[model samples]
Target: MATPRLFVKGTVLGYKRTRTIQRPSSTLLQLEGVNVKEDTGFYLGKRVCYVYKVGRESRCIWGRITRAHGNSGVVRARFQHNLPPQSFGATVRVHLFPSSI
Candidate 1:
């Protein structure tokens, strides 16, 4: 039997660095119930998706968790394209795939 995949819900907390930095930064995401640095490692390399609607059409930007950020259980994800400002405070999905199984 095939194993079921799990999708963890995360919130887009904005970019990786402070506003004054002025350089490009990876998107920051905080997973639900993940509030510690230790828990972030398990999610490294996991796939992330930001789904939104553009008029009648739905679109999604895919990314992967590249590394853990800070001690607050936040993660840094690099997407194929930079996410828009509207993505902040929005929800994203983290999928458990590319499994070791």
Candidate 2:
């Protein structure tokens, strides 16, 4: 038998860079239908992927949820490469990997 894989849908809000300094940045993701701060904990440390097409081929960028952002349920994610500005409002998949099972 095969094990089931889990994935949650989320949207990219933007980067975590501050004004006057943009050396380091983190992506912000908002899980679909998840609007409570407490619920964000469930996704911490989970794998996340943002897939986009460069042309006819699709490419994927992976990341992990670092922590919860604020009281509004947004979560912070650190990707191998910083997500582009065009990815804002784009959808991403949060994989339930690195499981404890």
Candidate 3:
């Protein structure tokens, strides 16, 4: 059987950017059904994964939610490696493991 779904899907809106610069070290994500900042509290420190394909190989970059980005539910994440620019608009998997519950 296929692995059961146990994670939330998030969107890779883009990297954190300033007026004239972009910081790839951090990325901004909006989780499904999360519309308010308070809803993001539970996801903080949660694991995030960006999966992609290169040639015939599938690769994944792991990261963790660092903090809430704004009044909305977007959260900031720091990854082991900076995500590619192409990741913009891509889908990310937010694992609910390592739970504090």
Best by TM-score: 3
Q: Which candidate leads in lDDT?
A: 3
Q: Across residues 1-101, which tens digit of lDDT does each residue of candidate 3 receive?
A: 89866899999999999999999999999999999999999999999999999999999999999999999899999999999999999999999887897
Per-residue lDDT for 5-99 in model 2, tens only? 57989999988767765533688889987798998887889999999998899999999999998899999999998888899999999998767
TM-score of every prediction relative to native: 0.88, 0.85, 0.93
Ranking by TM-score: 3, 1, 2
Question: Scored by Cα lDDT, where does model 2 land?
Answer: 0.88
Q: Residue 65 of candidate 1: its Cα lDDT?
A: 95
Off by over 4 Å in 2: 1-5, 19-24
- List the lowest-lDDT window of 10 residues for candidate 3: 1-10
Cα deviation of 66, candidate 2, in Å = 0.2
Worst 10 residues of 1 by lDDT: 16-25
